[model samples]
Target: MTQPEQVTFPAARADATVDAVVARMRALDAVLPARDGVAVFNRVYLTVTEEIGRRLRGGEFPDPRAATALDVRFAERYLTAVDADAAGLRPPACWRPLFQLRRHPGVRPLQFALAGVNAHIGHDLPLAVVDACRAVGCEPADLEDEFEHVGEILVVLEERVREELMPGPDLLQLADPLTHLVGSWSLDRAREAAWAAARALWALRHRPDVAGEFTDRLDAVAGLAGRMLLTPLGHRTPRPR
Candidate 1:
């Protein structure tokens, strides 16, 4: 495998603030190619973060401090995964497929975007929940509202992305394998799985071994779905409009 492209994001450290995360994402947006798969996902995620930041400023979250902590921790997981990939170290199972398939000519931008969503929500969100819980000194139940709110934003974003990226009416034939391929993944299912995983991890927190094993399994399962989403169709597909 080739060394991944060098895209510098802020280090995922104890003091990594949300502003720093947004700044790093913006930097990535400025430098990465528009057509790059990771760039596609990064743009969508950056939008989501910007919206969250706006909401935070608007006093939308019931517990603003908790929300900020959750958002920053959630983003750090994705950044950490990317950093690991860049260093040629093993990333989490969910992220490996995207990093490996990032430059494939046959994969469409929408596929790249959706695959990143899958890995983040499926594998990263649940763990991030636990991280936030620890940081906020609260239980997962306390962050439920914020979690659902963020998921709602992602659901809306996914719909718009699908609408914008879908091929024209002339290319919407059921016979096209791309149709079935794109239809296989669902953000709703991923969101549901994330909540369940969060609850399970919270329950197993005292048992580090069990929690570690469960997260590993979740990562591998999500990675499998990402790999399926990224399957190269051997033809050029329309990029997102």
Candidate 2:
């Protein structure tokens, strides 16, 4: 007797919250300007925060309060990631961006945070988008424009955050370094980083046994960095607009 044919199951859809957050981020990048990468970071920050709130309300986390904490925690992590990536590059760019970033007294810390966040988030977000697109049988290249849109939103958010949070004498000086950093970055590099981050996250998602371990490690790194860079700032309290 002939053996029956075997069937294969389709890949599972990505988590809805992750998809929603990435989609919104991509949208923000579309309208982002070349000189405004920080804006994209800011929008992603707010979007992620809101999503965490939603997930908490829906009881998606073991401790609902953890969701709220993640909102702020991730924002700082994103910033740190961007800074670390930029620092790793060689000269004549080595530390040039960092030097420029230091020019803004009031806005420097925030800009540093945003840059770090962008570098790190940019590394992974594109990959996630590409994977999702592929899962739906779409070309990853098609998502490039969307990624740029998210970048734009990040710039806008950064500007708005600065305007609201640090409207000090040197506030406008922040724009110069930001413009320089954006101009220095190539889209290709951003795309590559995105691909890496997405694949890493994808791997973590599929391996349930290690997912907690991976997140715990990420949390530990982020926590250590946050304590070093963010805890001293004491600027989490959003200024009234």
Candidate 3:
């Protein structure tokens, strides 16, 4: 349950930069045990953020400024949740499952990683788009190109976990529960849904009441998906005597 000591440049600052978020992830990576579920997710996310940084430097994103803003905002949400959980406060519904199950012995690292991915991509991405739009003085459509590029970078995380974390095709049967769990969610679909949700949220911004309700539902649905993803596939659960 312990997070690392404060990063020199916290991501929560008004003028937060992507570097600050990266630093925070590095700090968490350094302190969290490898087996901890949050740590597993953090490791995957750290790799993803680093890849985005590289892509940004390489001018892969057409709008680097917008991309940076979106990335920073997106990361800040998750870091804030981590801080909240560390402080014994409840995180958003989408994030609650991961935090609650972070230390569960029955869940596999892949489940932890994907469940975190589910919460972040499904819930945080849309809100981050809006926050970034407001910060950058643009609209959600303006950030679509940037969003797509960032998503492509995120796509790598799934590919990586499948290759590195899977029990192997030879050992993992087609009917394996782990296989089904991994198959149940699709990151590409999630990314598309997030984009649509962002657009919908932007359209509903004028009606805060409706928008708030929409976001609440979004959080709940994503949390449900996370709960499903975190289903224990291991034999760690004890049988009745």
Candidate 4:
């Protein structure tokens, strides 16, 4: 698989900022309990959604410059968090069962079960923020494109995490954190959290005024969600076949 291009910033400070976000995410992983992975993922995701809802409903932009900073921070935080998790080898061999389950007869039902949830949390909500930006004569096109780019990055991260961390032996073993987490929920809760965080960041980008505070909070949320996505603790496999 093609790796994402090296993330670079225009200035030294920007690069440092990105690195800091990555560091923070990495730190979070060290402290999280293995058992509470799903719960943590849900909380983070919910927080992201709540933040975005706040901005969308408020319709105010106080500090455009600060908002811009927030946008960059959020983007960096998200990218770094995912990248950091991808760096770790979690489940040790998660792909074997993931591949097997893909062909299962129940896969379609599983996908459908989570489709609405993912759609609202991932696509629709972010798009709404993009629409709001367009309505306000902001550079919606560029921001939307950036959002799409981030999604692409996320897909790559997920694939890598699956390949590296999934259990190879006894793919169905209960001790396999990746398999257990992915197969536990009807639809993976981590996806919801990631989507919610993405949507929230998108919404915050449009406001630009409160971006700083939003970015700080989002950094924490995204970090948690990213861990869930990478680690077996909170992950749910794509619907059963």
Which candidate leads the pack in lDDT?
3
Superposed model 2: Cα runs more than 4 Å off = 1-44, 47-116, 170-241
lDDT of 3 by residue, 122-230 (tens): 8999999999999999999999999988888788778988788776664334657888878989999999999999999999999999999999999999999999999
Question: Candidate 1 — which pairs collide?
Answer: none
lDDT per residue (tens digit) for residues 35-138 in model 1: 88888999999989998998889998889888888899999998888777767788888988888888899888888999999999999999999999999899
Give candidate 2's whole-model lDDT.
0.42
TM-score of 1: 0.92
Alpha-carbon lDDT, every model: 0.86, 0.42, 0.87, 0.37
lDDT of 2 at 72: 33
Query: Candidate 1: where is the Cα deviation over 4 Å?
Result: 1-6, 168-173, 236-241
Best-to-worst lDDT order: 3, 1, 2, 4
Q: Estimate each model's TM-score.
A: 0.92, 0.34, 0.92, 0.32
The Cα RMSD of model 2 versus the native structure comes to 17.2
User: Lowest summed-lDDT stretch of 10 residues in model 3?
Assistant: 2-11
Task: Estimate candidate 3's alpha-carbon lDDT, on a 0 to 1 scale.
Answer: 0.87
RMSD of each: 2.6, 17.2, 3.7, 15.1
Write candidate 2's Cα lDDT for 191-237 as tens digits. Answer: 45555554455556668677556544444443333223322232233
Q: Which stretches of candidate 3 lie over 4 Å from their true place?
A: 1-11, 235-241
Query: What's the count of clashing pairs in each model shown?
Result: 0, 28, 0, 15
